[model samples]
Target: MGAATAAALVLSGCSSPYDGAASTDGRSPGAPGTAAPSRPAVTPTATAHPPNDAVGRQMSWMLGQMNTDPVSSDVSSRFTEQFQAEVPPAQWLVMLGQLRAQAPWVLESVTSDGKAGSASVVAQGRRYSLTMTVDDAGRIDGALLKEGAQGETATTWPQVEQRAQLAAPQVSILAATVGDDGSLEVVHRSGEQGVRPIASMFKLYVLAAVAEQVRDGALSWDQQLRLTAQDKTLPSGTLQERPDGTAVTVREAADLMIRISDNTATDLLMRAVGEDTVRAAAARAGATHPEGITPFLTPRQMFWLGYGDAPQALDARAKWAAADAQTRAQLLEQVPMPGPGPENIDMTSTPWRSGVGWFATPQEVVQAHLYLDTLAGDAALAPLREILTKNGGIAVPDWSEQAFKGGSDSGVIALSFLAPPPQGTQRRQALVMIGTGERPVDEETFVAATADAARLLSEHR
Candidate 1:
């Protein structure tokens, strides 16, 4: 995922909507403002080329716009029509603000294959890469700023693990290779049995359940479902913005749920497939603690349960937990929908406590992935693999196919990857990392550690 999209996800509470209240502007409370600094001239590297000059100029201009009033109409004029449409001015400004908050960057070099180009830059005393595609009109059609090679070398798994062990309440990792015979072999594991809050990763079980129904001819991928006012969820998706009765296909809902961790899409799918069905699927997948998800709470319910004032919130949770699916659904109908306002609830203050959020061990997560693999042939499973591509931040060049699912909320981070080995290699592999603490887990550090660990497994396999 791009940094902007990832930031948006984090801000939206994908790990668990109960974390913190979102501001009216769609940012967390006290999010940094979009004030820009004065524009500065581009600093050319010692060996700057023509392509370098062109991209550097654009980069310099972009930085200037970001530094000064990014939301202004003048800054919006620089982007292509498609870019502007996809990213609104407010969102674009937020993204720019985040980039500026990172260390200032200086253009180093640019490389292109005629049609597309990439620029190297130094930031925070480390090198990073920015990629862009220029249209025939010389307007930027796509752009991405990502950690460069040097950033990867500066951190290692041991370093990250040590830091996590010290700073985090708990850290769990699991790596395994799928044999030709379809059995999984544990290659490495630490706290594999430790259970932690896995935020959106819980959606995988929901996906598996839906897949089984499709396989059994009980559900159709093309089946359309309508949205209601009650179906709207918080950020991380567009469904909440659509009007009532907006029809969407089962495939589309599933896609949105996995790709963006759409809370509304998740609830829609849960409602369509039946809550009991998802719970059954969890049992089949070997989830060690299915009760954690019993009487599954949609994002809205989670918010109310976690953020509603103390005594009332506790009473609601107790009643909801005691009720069956039928009664729980009725209770949900009475729950007030979330809206913009100051939030008194804060999940980050105590990350170790599991409230209404999803919880599972690394082994259960692996089991869920393994079960999904067994149903890969089912037509319903097809879109899932495709949607998962959005979450593959760690690139494994040799892997022919990679599917990923990640989750985070205030103080929790979870990542899962399913990669089929390259041609001539018969093994499939899965890697999972789960972290929890009072302090938020550093995304870049966690991603690098997971990537490095996966790399080691791939090389030795």
Candidate 2:
């Protein structure tokens, strides 16, 4: 609530010659770059500096607002702009309270001197630095924070190695790697390796399943088919309302399912592949929850199925033995589906039907990519990657060589990429990010998280 409490006790010792301890014209020190004389005084300026009162109150209000929940982008941006335009001189406590309250789930510690300050915040389960400086007033003069590490924390051999071994939150990255020998590899999860629902990421498996049929002569990408009522299941990809009674090729369906994430197209492909086959393929690829289509069942369907079969389907469950009820429910319910068939189809309509909603660890995600790559080589991986790497309607050039898949269900977000390293680069990287919380999943956060993770892996390679 006060600057003294927010700042570290005994803040005076942390100083340097450039820290400005004197004043000019025989007055006590007041501003930067002034060679003023020093004087022992009891009362300092109540406001910090520059645009003092306005800035302090603004920060105070920002900190107060954060007690409700994490600050939304709109809230953060508004405060950021206002604070910058009208900064305070000595409102360091306001900064501490604001950062801590705004990201309570992430921030760890905060400390400040009159000049420079630092705070520790957790992101993706790893600690990161947020450093800033204050002018004579308590407004932020400068600030710096990165999604990754600043430097090694330890000087000792084992400590340094251990620090190096630590994984950032973004390490859940999934990607494809091309080696020096032209061989492709995938690296999925980097830390706390655990199995997570792939959601739409499982669509890659559906794509691979279809590709397998193509390789075995059971199906052809160019083959055409009718959009029957049976194909109107929930979560169906591009198989939505196409020209009614119009015909389209299997390749086109695959393209829309992978590229546009079309739900109806996904449903048709699923029916073609059969739920059993898709589950089998997913299991072979090490998917932990291979119930596949079952996870996308409606609540009533889940009730009828006893909720024990596809634990990932229902968005809420009161299990006799478990704590991840919300997560399990989110994993199950968030999957997309299409409308029911015309034969009295009464179940909840899924946005993307033929798609997969199975749970897989980030490693399983990489393995899924590998399974597909092994079958049709780069060709099968291409279309999906093109759409996913676009980062939501915007094209990114570096992603041209990247073939990947992305999935989102409620609070869960997943991405699996298989791409060539930039020209002349050898090692490949897999980046996966899985977020399961009550917080709304923003697409920009996903893209930024993935990009940051990929950059981290690239730097080490």
Candidate 3:
């Protein structure tokens, strides 16, 4: 799950549509209304982290807690009672005990004792060293502390930030805001802002075009389309084997295109809206990466959109042998090609279906998302959002939330999402992460950096 998806769960008043209101283990959302069960009283555990880590940046703030005497549980209970005017004796006892167990620890000592500000502590069964410093206002204003043989150093925070920047040199972020008055602020942009080819993110435009068709009364949302063998683009996405007679509704095709990134469905949808119309829609939405498609669709997009054009007469036989059985069958059945079919066949081989040489900048992809958002409440747009909200083909953490479209090419991975802070604070912002690496960028690194960035911004907001 990404932060955006996680925030969506927080906002939806449930973890997910499939999951009930309670946690998987059945924990309720609201605080226990009755007297809370008591657990063993815990001493303040010395929280340890890397110097450049998140906790390191806030060490100064934690240190400030030592300045004022740690308040007792009785005081906390009294404050709660004062605010509530009636805490009920049972609740008061629970809160009082909680406050007592979790007071801030004083910065007893620093290990290296240098400007970097490292310190060590023995709490519970573990011992940890301090990393960085934060002021009374929770601002990161100090260097990280050094570490010993084991555990975190103060420099952990900066190191993570440095690693994140290096991993994702380019990023495009997209965000949406629905103000108190229902005014929407949707922004789509890239990190540097120039010509960038948006791959699967272009589906947003396809969805928009579908919505326009719906508006014009040319297509019904429930109308069904057939998926023949020709549509199968395999290995990664869902353009696998299918009978020529297989039928899918327009809505179903839309669902597959966005949810599972079905390439064949995209092609069918493109046919409905016309490739030119789709490009025009993107252009209208201010996408700088939009371009005219070649007369022939590339193998990758063919896999992405779910279908491929027929091969020329001379090479049809050779192309047929190379394609999967289902894909070959589709070619034989539906594709309009000139060449004869191939001689030898190998059904087991699966080629990399990276699609045509399409390119998109992070900013343009974000703008594409912005365009899709503009079609809010439209019937055609509704299902696409549902698919994005339900499952983005990418594998993100279950803890983070995201309703997004993801696209990846040889050197680029692009995504645009509007996500709130995981803590669910007052802050509402969007994130666009684009990574182009000499080697394939690590997904974990991208996710962590994006999460950290969202968290940092949320706290500041």
Candidate 4:
């Protein structure tokens, strides 16, 4: 559920001379009284100046491209030739599209460090720090956009939990570690057993089912499926950008769904494997409220259900939920699809509380990951482990093997990680972080707390 942004990497070969002023003893060269014979006034060597405005100019061009044709070759021209060669324009456009979906990112400030600089950008009520490097010609060579650090100093697990509770009174956080021996240990928790909205973390169950089918020979890893227009969902994926009828193997789809949390991929895979399979998987995984996602939703469907304005939409959803399997299938065919643009859904309100999304408890969430790990042995789970490494946002250096899946929508945010014990140790560990409230949770604070929780668990282990 996280929107991805494009970052530019620049390699510049330029240096600026220091602007130190040269001084002579204020005494006249010849004598106090003699106007020193006018020698050619030494023209101060023109100081080579740093490209202080390079970041500003490059950002201006980037903003313009974002406003105009972000997908065009012209937009790619803003980047250095080498950069464009290294990264495809289509990939750039995909990232730009995600940014466009969350527009009005205002420039806060820019600070320079030699040829490199960092820009603070604010959008969607959050601040991100974008770092960029310029080439000698001033073309943007590289840039990266990520969440801005909240200036708060680091604190211990107890302090983080207390502050998180105060900052988000409605959020219930749970932090626990499970050793290799399968011992579940609670480190810090509040409202740990509450069934709060888990956003995309529910996909773990769907993934488990898919893996099970592969193991049972019910589905082949190489089975190819077409991407019809109807299967397309919103951001956090590349599938939507692909042309209709594009073919992808079952294994590829599952990787995208879990690695990037692609909505369209999830929907297509769910449809392909059958929703009943995923439901049963969730139940087997120890989900306390599998019914919360009984009628699993694609990203598009979730948006329509949570934000669509048509009155009958809610009625249809209600009937679908209450209907039997056959009747629900019939009603699902009649469900409305949302148009592409800003949604009318009031995110600040408790839309999730209306039961339009998925929900699960902390222990259940952890159990789901552990269940999947057990069900899919090392060889079968290799692909899952491979893709999970792409999750650079949540990586911790000390852990030998780490896998993560996180979700966020409006007032809900959930992060789950499975880290195996260090070499020569039999203990493996899992960490789950959940936050929800009537209002939107502060992403910076929540992320910091999660990092602290992970560090604490690692230290204790």
What are the TM-scores, per candidate, against the unseen true structure? 0.74, 0.48, 0.48, 0.71
For candidate 4, write residues 358-404 as lDDT tens digits: 87888888888788777656575556666554454354566755767
Q: Which is the leading candidate under TM-score?
A: 1
State the C-alpha lDDT per candidate. 0.62, 0.44, 0.43, 0.62
Q: Could you tell which candidate, 1 or 2, scores higher by lDDT?
A: 1
Better of 3 and 4 by lDDT: 4
Off by over 4 Å in 2: 1-192, 233-238, 284-357, 378-399
Model 4 residue-pair collision total: 8
Candidate 3 lowest-lDDT run of ten: 16-25
In order of listing, the candidates' clash counts read 4, 64, 59, 8
Model 2 residue-pair collision total = 64
TM-score of 3: 0.48
Candidate 4 off by > 4 Å: 1-78, 81-128, 133-141, 144-151, 162-167, 316-334, 338-346, 422-426
Cα lDDT of model 2 by residue, 150-220, tens digit: 23444333332233223222224334465644343643334445655455666666777777777677887
Better of 2 and 3 by lDDT: 2
- The local distance difference test score of model 1 is 0.62
Cα shift from native, residue 215, model 4 (Å): 0.2
* Per-residue C-alpha lDDT of model 3 across residues 115-181, encoded as one tens digit per residue: 2356654322222234543334433333222111221221333433454554445554433443433
Per-residue accuracy of model 1 over 235-333 as CA lDDT, tens digit each: 455677787899989888888777667777887888888878998998897787755776666666676665565565556566764566576566556
Judge candidate 4 at residue 83 and give its lDDT: 73
